[model samples]
Structures are given as C-alpha cells and as structure tokens.
Target chain A: MTSILASAEELTGGVCCGASVAVPREASGCAMEAVRALVRRRVRDLTLIAVPQAGFQADLLIGAGCVRQVEAAAVTLGEHGSAPRFRAAVSAGTVEIRDSTCPAIHAGLQAAEKGVPFMPMRGILGSDLALHRDDWHTIENPYGENDPILLLPAITPDVSLFHAPRADREGNVWVGVNRELLTMAHASRETLVTVEAISDESLTSDVRLAAGTIPSLYVSAIAEAPRGAAPVGLPGYYDEDTSHLRRYAELAQTEEGFDRYLAEQVIAAPAPA
Target chain B: MSEAYRPEELLMSVVAGLLEGARHVAVGAISPIPAGGALLARERAAGRMRVSILGSERHTFFTDGGRELFDCAAQGRIDAFFLDGAQIDGSANINLVGIGSYPRSRVRFAGSFGSAYLYFLVPRVILVAHEHSRRTLVDRVDFVSAPGTSPPGVYRPGGPVALVTDRCVFGFDRAAGRFSLSSAHPGQSVGAIRDKTGFEFTLDDAVATTAVPGAAALALLRGSVREALQEAYPEFAEHVLGQAA
Candidate 1:
C-alpha cells in the first residue's frame, strides 16, 4: 500500500542505509526537504545515482557523510559555482565517484524501466568516461557489420526521491514538464515524493493535469512539504533562492562551516507541520 | 563602433557569429554567454532558428524530459551546441573531470555533463573557455571527458568546429585534428595569444581581427536579448548585461 505521510521526516523512513537512491537533474523539483530529513536520520553508505546531473542536494548528502558513492554526469551548484562539499569529498577521497554522461544515465534508467538487462547507446566510444566504466560494454552491432556501440547495464535504484507541485489523496503526483521524474519513478523500486500540497480532488480527473500525472501505482509514498524545493525552486511555484544558495556555497566551503550550516538550518529548524 | 561593450558581450557576439546558419541550437546549463548568443541569433534569424536553453521555462520546448535533448541531437535535429572545459588541448580535447589521474585528482572539476555524447552527435560544437591560458589550454588534458577526435569506425558526425576564448578564436579542423588561429580579438595580438596558450596551433599570415558587435547588435543584446535571458540567468542579465532582472 502507498504510504501517505504528513511530514518529510516520515516520508524518508522508507529509505534504508546502503540503498541506491536515484535523483533528478535540475535544481528545481528536487526533494530538498526529504534530503534534510535523510541527513538528520544519518542514513549511511548510500549510493547516489543522479539521473543525469545533480546540484546542491547531492552536495548536502555528501557533506553530511550519507553517500558512499556518486554516479552522475556532473555535480555542480550551477551559477553559484562547483558544489563545495562534493569537490571536497572528491579531493579527500572520502566518496567513490562513478562518472557517467547524461544520455547514458537516462539510457540505463530506461533499460530498467523496460525490464531489459542492458540498453544500447550511441557516443562515449572514444571518451575516458567509457574507458573507465568497466560495466559499460562495447559490442559490434549484430544487424550492421563492423559497427560498434556502447551498452549500459540497467540502473535499477532501490529508491527514487524528488519533489513536485502537488499530489492527489490517491498518490498520483503532478510533476508537470519535469518528465525525467517519471523515468526515475518507473526505474526505481520505490518512488518517494514530497509535494507542496495534497489535493483532495483526483489529479487525473482533469484531462490537462492527467497528461503530466504519475499514477498512484508508481508512487510508494507522499509527503506534504510546502516550499519543499526551496533554495532550488519548484519551476512555476517559485524562483530559485539564489541568495540562500550563494550563502550555502560560501558556508559549505569548509568542514566547520558546513557543520554550522547543518546545525542552524537543518538540525535546529522546526519540523514540518 | 564608439559604444563600449563588456567582455561577456564581446564573447556573446563571437558566439552569435559562429551560430549564424544553425537551424536549432541548444545551450547547456550555466552558459549565459551562449544562451545570450543563441537568443541574439534567434532574433536575427527572424524566428527561423529554434533556441533551447536548459533550465528555462520560457526558452526550452522539451516536454519529454532531459533525455530528449540527447535524442534530438542524435537524430540530427540539433545543428549547433556549446561546450566548456576546465582544460582544452590543441587537438580540441576537453577535460571537465578535474586534473590528475583518473579516479583521483589534484583539482577536481565539475564532472563531464553531456560532453561525451553531445560532442559526437551535434555537427557544430563550439568550444568556449573564457579563461585562455596554459593552465586552461593544456598540452594534453589529464582526463579526456570527451575526446576531440576519434579513431576510424567511430561513428562521429559532430565534433568541435571552433574554440572562442577571451584572447582569440581558433578554428578546429577535424580532418587534420588540429586548431588554426582564425582571428584575434580586438586589442589582442597574435603574439600575445601565442604566449598565453599552452597548446600548439597554426597561425595564418592574414589572421583577421574579431569583429565587435555593432550598435544594432548591442541594442538588441541589451534590450530584447537581455530581457529574454533574465528568466534563466537573472544574475548574468543584471550584472553582466547591466540590466535589472
């Protein structure tokens, strides 16, 4: 049965230590609240699979020492600059980095979504990204002679987490135009989402909203956390809190500063109502 | 000609010039200059060109998700794309995955985004690196996040066409696997660019000076283009273009 929780902390209970967690790319629609909850829980040895890319959320997890590994195309703060904690972690050899490209990450998830062992993809032929990843195999095309292609093994994450605009009581999430969230949900064993509000009416009742809705069947849990994707923004709902993010970028530069940020913003903060 | 322009505006003009004939152009994340250039090109093309700037609600048309961009590029729908690197070699090799050996590094950069895939699929890839020096333009990249050139039988239709930096523009020849000094930016000499660059490149005797944006171009940039760009890059529009978002 799908778990409908009232708080972000409760929604994060489904996540287990050492589990592989898949996250979306864009700064917007990221499960920042749930990430904080997870950080507070001190979930350890996590394998973070960024759908294609990552931003502040990945950095926070790495900073909190929750992630053991990161598999993504990139982890940056975007305009704010490089993700400080992520950079520090990589520099200190504290976290294992499994480098991947954008399309390859998507293809791997698509493979999982289709229940395939692997998916064939173009490019990455001459890249060191291909060279380093032993699991990514290169095989000659069976139909076309002498044509070699790279094959990525399915990336079936244990959990997929993100934020959205809203969800119905039935757990149907309205992710709108961020369709990669759908791919993440379909590919993972469990999809945990935090939304701005819990709609009493069914999202699928309307034809327009239904087109972008993720059916309740795919969602394992839902939490109502208003302004949940703060600092990152939630597309139409709000703009990015750049000042806050810029402050994070500066504070997260050092270990001591990061710890203080956790203490003030995360640990001491009141729990979601 | 008398009007002054910021360095970013100058770079934007150069990028716009490179994207002249492209039907569809995609700008990746955190690339305000390329985004500006694409917007400017779209304005000049009279809506014939499609500009997709990632992270913008107004600019992008992709509803199928992040993978759609890569899919579109592979199908040859995208004509031009922009890429940046922490280190770019003479051969056009780009390194986004930090300096030093693989897995471990002295200076770890933001890992390669989609360069490995898009660099091969997009026909015209413009390499943009604002910091043009020996440190950035290395003799050989420590890590080839996306190789500039591929061996035979490697199906590659797209690779770097040119590299634009603060100093000058270097036109890439895929057939020769080399870069030739195409043009020097205003007030920059060929000798000065050579001194700053670490990688080797052929310099033609008649290297032209990069044309600065004219009054009309500047007007469009500071007006409509800057306004359009604000949605995605408010800081860039405000500080770089000197406009309030």
Candidate 2:
C-alpha cells in the first residue's frame, strides 16, 4: 500500500492504507514535485487537514491565480449576510485556507504527539464565530471555566507533505525547528518528506537532529527539493518574502477579495482568473 | 495664544483630546503611532487606564516594564483600539491599498491586519494620525479596512467611537457611525479639518488642545516610557537612545 521508490521513482499514487509502510529515501528528487503534482491533479480533499505551515504558502497561492472560493467558519466577520470588506474567506477561488491559525490541527498534533485524545483551549467558548465546526469546539468541562476550548481532534492528514533540510538513504530526515511540523508529521495518515539536501549518511548520524523532534519512523516518502520553502522561508539562510506577505495580507482583507485571491492563486482555473 | 502652536505641538495636543476620557484601549498589528500612543496612554495614566497592545505578530518586548503584547486580541481581551488610516474619506472609509485606481495608483499601503475585525468588536476605536493631510483625510478609505458601522445589540457590531488626528478630534454619531468633529487642537480651524476630509463634519465650537504636559506629567512620561522600553527590550537601548534603563 505504498508508492515509495527505490531510486528516482516518485510516490505519485494517491493516499494508501496499511499497518506498515516504507517510503522512498530522500535521494529521490521528486518529493515537492509529487505534492505539487497531487494538487495540480486535484487529489486532496477537505478531509485532508494541512498543518500550520508547509505545503502551499497561502500568499503565494493567492498570487498564482489558483484560489476558487472561501469558507469562513471560525473568524470575525459578517454576522448576518455576506462577509464584509475585510476578513479571511472560507474558500478562495483555487483553494480554501482557514482564516486564523489552525490551533485545532496543531493542538491535535500535540495531543497525538503526547498520545492524548484532545487538547483544551480558551476563546471559542462564548462566540458562534464558526458554526458548523464542532470538530474544533468542546463545550464540556465539569469545572466549565475554559469550556469552549477546542478539542483539536488529532490532525491525521491523508498525507503530510513537508519540506526538510536533509535526509539519508533509510529516510531519516533533518529540518529546522519548524514549530508545528512534528505535529503534522505525527498526526498524518501518510508523511511525505521534502528536504533541501540529501546527505549520504542517515539523518540519525547528525547529533543535532538526533534530539528527535521528527522521529524517522513517521515519514513515508523522503524526496530532496533543495529549497522547498523558497520565496517563503529558508530557515537560517533567508527570510520570508515580506512584500509577498503584504500582498497576501492585502488580499485576505475581504471575503470576496480573498475568494478571488484563492481562485487567482490556488486553482488551475477552470481557466486562470 | 493657541494660534502660536506648531505642528508637533498640535500633534501632542490633538492626541490629548483623543485620549482624554479613555480608560481601556487596544492597539493592533503593524501600526507604529497607534501602538506607541496606547503605550503612552497607559504610562501617562497609570492604573487609572489600561491599554492592551495587540500586534498581529503576537510577540512583544515593551518600552515600559510591559510584558510582550502579542496575541491579546486573539484571546478577546482588548477593549479599545487606536486605528490608523492611509486614505480616510469623509465617512472615514480608510484606504490602505493604494491611491487612485487599483493597477495605477500612487501609494499602496499594507492593508489592514485586523482593523475591521477589531473595529467591529472593540468597544471603542480611536483613529490616530500623524499625517492629517487631504490625501490622508479623504472622504472614504480606498478600501474599508474596517467598517465604521455595526448592527444593534450584537457584541461585535458598531465601529469607530472616535477619530483623532493632528488637526482635530472626531466622534461618531452613535446611530450613523459618521465622524463628527468634537474638538480641535489649539489653533486648528474647523475649516482646516473639513478641508482635509472628504466629507463634511459636525463641528463643535473651538476648543483648545489639552493643556501642555505639566512638568510632573512630562517628566513621568519621559522617565516611565524610557524605563519601560529599556526594561522591556534590554537589547534595544542603543537603538532607543538612553531610553533603556
């Protein structure tokens, strides 16, 4: 049930299921392209939860003319009808990015990492900001103080696509201390590792990486893409594109505008908008 | 006597009017003046006033013994805000996008981080500006970073309780949310504020700027802010002058 490769063979097949899996080593150069290929092929669905970062940088997606629509469930905007002039959207034209930080997936990953059922959080208890989102809210606590803390059901992505710094033949990978990355990697059904460089030795060979934020067992396919977070982040070497950030911030100002952005950036356009 | 005031004097004076009665306020991401003013208010007012600085970056090292102020808004603790606008029209529609037409505009500002979100929710929002020019005081913002109006009864509706600028002070008509000139800084003419804005204003009789900082208040502001910033960001002392303790 795995599409991992022995050489440059890319894991291009859709999600697979199995008790044990073996993915391609990072020596393969098709990791990022495979994830992008999946998106280009329109494979992943809403049920597939993405992480805090890693995957398409939302801003770049907006500028690329791929967004399609926006669905805003847990955000601050339009109490009555359509969203106002400013507010993140539910479905941008090409893809849909949740309005705020995905504390749910993060918390869930944390819980998963800690081997727990749920994580409690504050701030969503009193408001009906995101209506159909019971998956993120828990109104029960005997003490009932932080009652509305999100349960953050474990993320368990259909596939976890992440860019790392390096990897070895056995699929051991190394990356910067990407805050929520381990959460996404651990909680996903499958893990796709995209590294910046491939080391001849197993990643476990590096003492720094041995501390184990992302244990090797969690990854499936490890491909090398040199600069996966390019134009967005390159940890230690460069900073994110600030102007790109400003542009995304500008587009995310309104529901309609954000939707237009999704269409323009994420979607392959029924025809590129 | 008021006629002798210069621009910077008018600025401090105008700021006083905007902050006159506020007890709790919020300042959100990416604004330097509003962020700085909210800090100034808390320092100057002490425990009598509470100001929450919300930077979208959600991290802070303060200027006055203050904890890093980040993620306060996400937690829903903010009460009021000091909002800034790039292009403010008569109705106070703020435009941060750019000047003129979309593709061919003059100045394009970083759009709102969450002004609209906070505007609708925060009990009071005070629009602060250092640049009170016609270009800035427009009739409407090129874009509505946040709306000035809110619905009745809902907690997050209604907007912009007050608008403060270097030229004058404005308050909204509770019902209309339109900006009304409540007071003018020393030497500022109603005509001047009106000329700067795109809409006509509900002007009140001339009022002098808030009195100059008393010797004690001035010394306290300088000392406390300096101490706070220094302690809050021990490393930035060189950048902040001797403000660090």
Candidate 3:
C-alpha cells in the first residue's frame, strides 16, 4: 500500500492534510488559516517549534489545548502585551516548556539542516538558560586555551509549517526575504505550507525569484489559502491585523476569556471543506 | 525655565548618548525605549547610523528572517544592541527565562530570545529596565541568559556596557566585573539608587545628574522617532510617547 504512494504529485496532497506540525512566527509569516483549521479539527498533543519568537498563534494553540510542548526563544504579544495563554500555562504548570534563546534555536535548526550533531555558539557562558538546557553543553575551544563555548544540539522538527506569498505549479515556494523559512523546511522531516496564491509560472523560471525560492523537493505539501498568514503579517504582502490582535490580547487575559475567544475565533469557524 | 521631560524620555536620551558612535544598532522584540534611542542616535548622526529594528519592514535589512540578524552579529556587522531581563545581578548576568529552577517552579518571562548569543557578539549592549528596585536588580540572577563577561580565551566582542533605569545610570567595568555609579536622574539621589538597587556596586566620588534631553532632542523624539516607532511598537508609541498607535 505504501509503495503505491511514491509519486511526487500525491505527496503534497497527503502532507498538507495533517494534524500536528512545527510553524513559523505567529506575529509574522505563519500558516494561520491552517492553524485555524487544525484548531477546528481538534488536533491535540502537538508539539510546535517557533522561529525565535511567537505571539497570538502560540497563545491560541495553548488556549485550545492543541499543544503539548513548545520550543522557541519567546512567546510574546509584542506591543499588545503579555501572551496571556502562555503566561497562564506557565503559572499553572500545564504545558511543558522548553525555554530557549533566539540564536540557540536557530543554531540548533541549522545543525539539523546540515546533519551535524551540534553547533557551537558564543555568549551563553554565564546564562541560566545554558545551565538549564541539558542538551546544551560547554566545551573548551581546541584552538584557544581557557576559552569555553556553548554547543547546542540539532533541532529537527517533525514538520515545517508556514504561510508564504506564493508557490509555483511545481510546488516551489517563493518566500521572498524570509529565508529562515527555508532553513525550517530543510531541517524538518516534512514541510507543509499555506500560500497566499499559486503562481501561474514556475518559481524557478525567473532567476531573481529562484534565489529566494524553496524548491518543492523540500516541500511535502502546499495548500492555497489566500491571506493564510492573516492577523499576523506576511512579508512583502500584508500587515498584521493589529486591532484583531489587540482584541485577542485583551480578551485572552483570563482562562474563560481565552476559551471564549477560541470558541468564537477558531473552534466555531467551520474548516474549509 | 526649560520644560521638564518624562523619566522615560530622559532614559532615552542617555541611551542615545551610549549609542552615539555605533555604526549599526539592532533592537529586538518589545524594546521601544531602546528602539527610540537608536532612532534618536540615527537622527543625531544625520541618518549615517544604520538602525535595524526587528518587526519593522522599513527599519530592518534582513531578508533571511531572524537568523540573519544573528549571523550578521557574528560577522561583526552590528555594533550595538539592547537587552532586558526579569533579574540582573551586579556582574551583569541576565535572567529572562524564569524566577525558579528550570523545567519547573516560578515565574517565566518571554524566553531569552537572542541575548545569550548577542551579548557576546555585539560590541555595545545597553541593559535597560524601567523598574530600579530590588526585585529587578537582584543579588544573583536565577538564570543567566547571557553572562556579562566570559573567560579570556573565549571570543567575545560584546557585553553589557551600561545600565539605564528610571533612577540612575551605572557603567559596567569589564575589568572590575562590577558596576560603577555613573549618574542619577533628576530628583533621584545616589542614596535613593543605593536603596533601590539589590546588587552591590562601586560608587564614584560624586554622582553626576543625568543630562536631560534638550529641546531639540525632545522635539525629534516626540516628532519623528515617536512616529517611526509607531510602525513597530504601536502601544509603546501611543502610551509612552503620547502618540496614537
């Protein structure tokens, strides 16, 4: 049965229709529509990997009980305020938190992309974050005496998920200046993307766009969801729905408020058929 | 008599002074004061200084997402940056992760972000915290997001240069691995700073009063920088600078 499923065309259809996956930042380019769909579908116990920082997406997932653990630099609502759901989860000891720094997460993902065991970074020597993370270890530089550095293990997520401006017919995505999305796709076992539009021409056809494009070989799935990163901005295309985000920030301050928000904004909305 | 300025505005002026010679300065998430300061510095430099503010399309130049900022810092492209913590000790160690033991226990902040890495990479790191009390300035940080100083053999180009608060300013001496009383803000005395600060530090003979932002600097802040800040930090611009988000 698995042998019959070996075609490239079938891969996108299979991968894009899944439940749990890693996602990009909620404040910026994320698969918000897919995240909404996942919430509506009642996906549970999913582990999400965020890009350095996240915002409403993390809060919403936590409020909906869709996440089991999260790995990221920070989960903040930015100018809006504290991420109410994340703060509540931490205080309640409900969710498993793997607190990480921005570069350490990025280094870890880069290591995974290169199939390296670990990547060494500078400046975390005295940080409590270094002390807490068992996977991160201190090692003396072979070249320099008495110099110690922090080495972080690779982070290969189960799925790389995001919202992009466009994907060509061949499935290659043009992410523009958001290149970390490329690294996420490269390091993850599977890539699921929601695009604002499907380009009529192949992304690789233009040499200029080709440099910014992620080849379909790394993308396991692609879904056409216009304004897929809504409420958060997509680079080069849209701005964050600031009022909506502020409203979420305000209403999500309490558990009841969060649940009410989830019920109305996410759960109550029907998944696209 | 000259018009008085807000405590935050005074702090921003001091921060701008610190950022004066920096060619490239980057401001991370939730840092409106530092962002404003950087913008002020840029304005002072007549747009000569490059300010890359995170979450702003107009300000930042990174095309490769968050990692690009870190990568650029590693290559010595960025000269200045800002970091704040839930707790900061005398040695300049920052704690952004939480209050208690890791994987469990107490309060948690929005994680470390890139402090650990950037603290080593960027040349000038200005530590900013609005509250100057014992809770914020601790004897020892529960967690170290980034150590102020590292061993000699380790390659480090960046660390805390100074700390600006509502009450005063403290200059970090890397050699002494301690903070020295630089100056106190208007209406704030050295004794008041001593009472507020949790960590012990060396004091100068006479603490100078923090320089107030002149009419020109104040004008630029309220006019251009405040308006520019609205793009990335709407609430901060509106609430802190009296501009609408």
Q: iRMS values in order, in angstroms?
A: 0.9, 12.3, 1.8
- Residue-level lDDT of model 1, residues B71-110, one tens digit each, is 9999999999999999999899999998887787778988
TM-score of 3: 0.91
Model 2: how far residue A158 lies from native, Å: 8.5
**Candidate 2 ranges beyond 4 A from true positions:** A1-273, B1-24, B47-76, B95-112, B140-142, B210-223, B226-245
For all predicted structures, in order, the TM-scores are 0.97, 0.49, 0.91
The worst-scoring run of ten residues by lDDT in candidate 2 chain B lies at: B61-70
lDDT of 3 by residue, A13-90 (tens): 343332345667754478777777766666678777778778888888888887878888888887778788887787
lDDT of 1 by residue, A160-224 (tens): 99999999999999988788898999999999999999979999999999989999899999999
How far out, in Å, is residue B4 in model 2?
A: 13
Quality class of the docking in candidate 3, CAPRI style: medium
1 or 2, greater by DockQ = 1
Where does candidate 1 stray beyond 4 Å? Answer: A270-273, B243-245
Q: Which one wins by TM-score: 1 or 2?
A: 1
Supply the TM-score for candidate 1. 0.97
